[model samples]
Target: MLTTKLGVLLSGRGVVAGDRVRDALADAGLTMRSAFTLTQLAAGPVNQQTLIDLLGVDPSAVVTVLNELEGRGLVSRQRDPADRRRHIVVMTADGTRTLHTVEEVLDKTDDDLFAALTPRERDQLERLLTKVADADSCAEKY
Candidate 1:
């Protein structure tokens, strides 16, 4: 009880959240990070450097992820024609279809995770968390 209150109050990392989320995503053969990477590419080709910055992951880690996605035919990395130096990551057609499928599964999984909370309470928590995240953005602006 106290821990749940404190989690909402402090907006700290939910230590077990990742494991649960991973389990939730496993049905789609996706990891949390892999799913996130797909969403990022859904916007369009992401430059390697931009991906590193946006995802806040190490360059080597990004490379490994890109390699894995490429092997799965979920994404492809091609050199930027305009900038020759950076590689742009783009999602494949299969990746798009898979992304939607995973999204549906993840939605259900998210509901399952939050099943302990009433729907109204879930909305309230989401609002509070959004406020906290917005505050974080405001803090970063300075």
Candidate 2:
């Protein structure tokens, strides 16, 4: 019963946070889907295969997402200099701006979500979450 309650609470919080982020992105004149895709590309230069691996999606789906991003001029793809046949994905200036906005929204969401905790409690919570995230079992889930 406790586990079920925790699951429901977590899912509800996730949905609310997602809605906030989507609204924030829309206010910044960007789509939430595009913002997410662009931010992923901004993390580093990645090939389609890398994106597929990171996103846990099929190659064709990733290609479709990349194509949409490219069409919006939010992301650019270039042939890898070392491997001309392979393409590398990079964020454009617009994408960088959108990513910055999204990050701000995420920061605010974090602050709001943890507002009930004292500063020390927040720090402890963060440490515990990070530890769980770095656990072997957690890595396997990813």
Best by lDDT: 1
Q: For each candidate, what is the lDDT?
A: 0.80, 0.75
**Candidate 1, position 36, lDDT:** 82
Q: Pick the candidate with the highest TM-score.
A: 1
What would the C-alpha RMSD of candidate 2 be, to one decimal place?
Answer: 3.5
Model 2 lDDT tens row, 1-142: 7657965877787798768777776777666556656767877789867777776656786688788778878788999999998899999897787678778877787788778999899899789867866674534321
TM-score for candidate 1, please give it.
0.79
Give the Å error, residue 107, model 1: 0.7
Candidate 1's residue-wise lDDT over 1-142, tens digit each? 7767975645444545556667777778887778888888899888889888878777787788778889999999899999998788999998999899988887786687688999899899889977877777544210
lDDT of 1 at 99: 92
